[model samples]
Target chain A: MKIALPIKFVIICSFLFLIHQIVQAQDNEEKIKMPESNNVCLNCHGHKYFSFYNENTEINERKLMNPYFVIDSISYLQGAHQGHSCIDCHSEDYGVYPHIAELKIEPKLTCVDCHDFEAIATEVKKSVHMEAFGEFFQCELCHDPHSNKLVKSDMAELVRYNNNRCLNCHNDVDKYQVFTSHENPQLLVTHDWLPNQALHFAHVRCIECHTAVTDTADAVHHIVPKEQAVKNCNECHSENSLLRDKLYKHQLKEDRSEFNFYKSFIINDAYIIGANKNYYVNLISLLIFGLTFFGILTHTIFRIIKRK
Target chain B: MSNTKLYLYPVWLRIWHAINALCIILLGITGISMQYTNIESPLINFNSAVSIHNLVGVIIIASYLFFFIAGIISGNVKHYRLLFKGLLNRLFKQGEYYLFGYLKGEPKPFHITKEEKFNPLQKVSYVAAMYVLVPAVIITGVALLFPEMIIEKFYTMSGIRLTTFFHSLAGFFILIFLIIHLYVITIGKHPLKNFKSIVNGYHES
Candidate 1:
């Protein structure tokens, strides 16, 4: 009886200890802000948001760094990770105070991580840059993934900005013998003598040739390559010039072409003309038919009444 | 078969039907014109035609909403809800009648009642056209009008392509139905009885 009592007591104590350990473990997980493995994070956060961000993938890690701390889940997950786990890049302190900001991580990826950039860079090295600058330029020199915006330049703006800039590079007098600045009084005086055959806007400015704006001030103006600008005849030509001065009569030209081509062309334009013709003919026929029927019915009734 | 005197068409129903029919006719014409824009403009002024087309589209939308509301309030929706009992079998039977028995002068398998005005064939076509085809076309039409909103979430090129195809396919189906509907109108007691009833809001029993 005595031995049985002691054995029962021991068993009870062991059960209590096991319960205590489980409670302690739960508390530990809740209290501390430690960086966990990707698995641990995923268990708490749903897999849907985290699936694409696994750390094993290859993306850029350099541009994603923060200054103070480095627990940034986004940067860590996005950087050089094809199938990486949370623990691969992040310190255990990730869940701690302002870990993401300390890391200064942005989620933009790098091409070198997924692709063989060395091969591409080798080919790029063989280009004119190596000959001009004696060194191959990196991707960051021409393009920044985080900041690259497509710059579209208008024609008028391109002309105004580029004239002086062009002279800086192409200062050879013989190269631009035909081209002179309107700012020069001599050129303006000479320009007045000729009947304005070319439009003022049609004259290509120096800025038309210059694609790059090297300074911060130029970016403020939203300047881009001149070719992207809208081009139409109305941008330059005066209404009076088109109405009378121009030798080419657009309407006359159109009518002449229509006469010659309408019968022979089985194109979309011809079909359009055919449909228009049909519409008019059908409309006129319908009107005549309706009016004739009404007129005849009225006349018959009148005649019948008179005879009666 | 002799329950023609049991029910009368309501004024609102007749007006709704006329408006709906007219809007559909206009939509069909405009949709055809838009598709073949390279062909000459049938309505003389381009801007006027577009404005009229958009106005007609809005009218169709408003009329559909009114129809739905009226159907629910009048307890007329009950006539549309099909009993599932032997539904597939009945559908097949109805299909067979249309395929073969219809040409043989056999009596229609389903009868119209005061409670249910539509026969099985009419029920199926009406249900398919109103619930499926009509809603599909409306959704596509709305998407086309406010493309920016719809494009934000589900903007796959394939999705847009499919929507366009379904819209045109609905047009094709409506064209087929219009021909059949016209023919059916001629099948009444008199050649012009159905047309007169629609216009005058009364049919001679």
Candidate 2:
């Protein structure tokens, strides 16, 4: 009975230890399981030419569907979603071979899922691109999921990036000519009155003129028709130009006292001649002109008849 | 007494004067309209005003060049030259004549001659207006036209702002001069005497 009891105790202890080990193994397996499954999906998709042909093509015809299914692995690794696992976006059950037809996988993940949707939505709502294209305008239209390297803090780069995205569609003059009435073959001719047209074209972004000045955070996005674009030289040439609010927001004085509304005019890298006009000088000149006019008027009144 | 005719303004000077006057009047109207863009003009729209202002500014500059060339070539420049020897004394006398003497029916302090067409005060004012003020206006106007050419900054202001300020100041002085010139023309022996003199290059003294 004593031997049986000891044996029973040993057996119970061994069974408990086995159970504990099994649980520990399961916990470790669960931790690594996600990455393993992700690699399995990447096995087929990671190839440079990984794309499925449309099976329903006629006997003589062949067509490829989802031609860009292959992800540039290097670029994806360095992308904004580098931290995220494939399952995080592809939430559907992609476990089975050839991914079940009934199991609908989201074609594209929404940027709103991770970003500040409200802020983005506010600016996007006012954007002319949205006005023309409608709400279906996906974030992917400008930003590529696998290759996007946009960083908001780097302003000059961000400006160049945004401008390049616009130029992608706009640079095709023949395509643009069909829709807009401004049929000038040379686009720069539209701004012929502006001196140093080449310099302006080289330095200034199209959005600076095409966009309406709005008090909103992203005024550059709120573009207008060419007809509605700002034609006034004073808009940029004056002491309080709209560019100061849009592009040079960083240079704005934090302390109100430090800001001289009259004299505080400067652009970051390049200089705009009229944009830096002074209000105090204008006022002083006006005063002096007024005094001179008054003096002349009084003098003229005193001269009437000749004395002997 | 028989009306004595004095050959005063030459044909080139008269033509220059007429064009300059027209340009100034148009510029003044357009300039004011441009400055106060919100106020609707009866004469022309804002865009038209700006276009006309620019056009008239170019015309005024051209006329100024003509005047300069004509003055130098014709020796009419002598008429505007201030006599430094008795400049202050003559100016005081002319000033007194305009201030009190003219009102009491006194004879004129300075008489017009071929070489000395302007009185001391007239010479001083004309020299300042034509030489200093007009050139300043032209430089500033041209600067405003081609802001890109400007060096971006002057003293405490941008070159554009400084130029614009000076341009407006000069315009104001020119406008005052025009008003005074018109009033003085009416004070001649006959109401239309000076007006006829400008038209036919002869003044009745």
Off by over 4 Å in 1: A1-308, B1-4, B39-46, B95-104, B152-162, B200-205
Task: Say what the RMSD of model 2 is.
Answer: 18.3
Which pairs clash in model 2?
Answer: A237-A274, A305-B102, A306-B105, A306-B106, A307-B105, A307-B106, A307-B107, A308-B105, A308-B106, A308-B107
Q: Which ten residues in a row are the worst by lDDT in model 2 chain A? A: A58-67
Cα lDDT of candidate 1 equals 0.48
Task: Please write out the lDDT profile of model 1 over residues A47-91, one tens digit for every residue.
Answer: 222222335555423233322222344433433332455544345
TM-score of every prediction relative to native: 0.40, 0.62
lDDT of 2 by residue, B1-205 (tens): 5667788887888999899889989988887656544422234565577779889999989999999998899988877776599788989999887667766768888887776778888888889889988888888888777867876556644455556667877887777777677766666566688888899998778
- Looking at model 1, give its docking quality level: incorrect
**Model 2 CAPRI rating:** incorrect
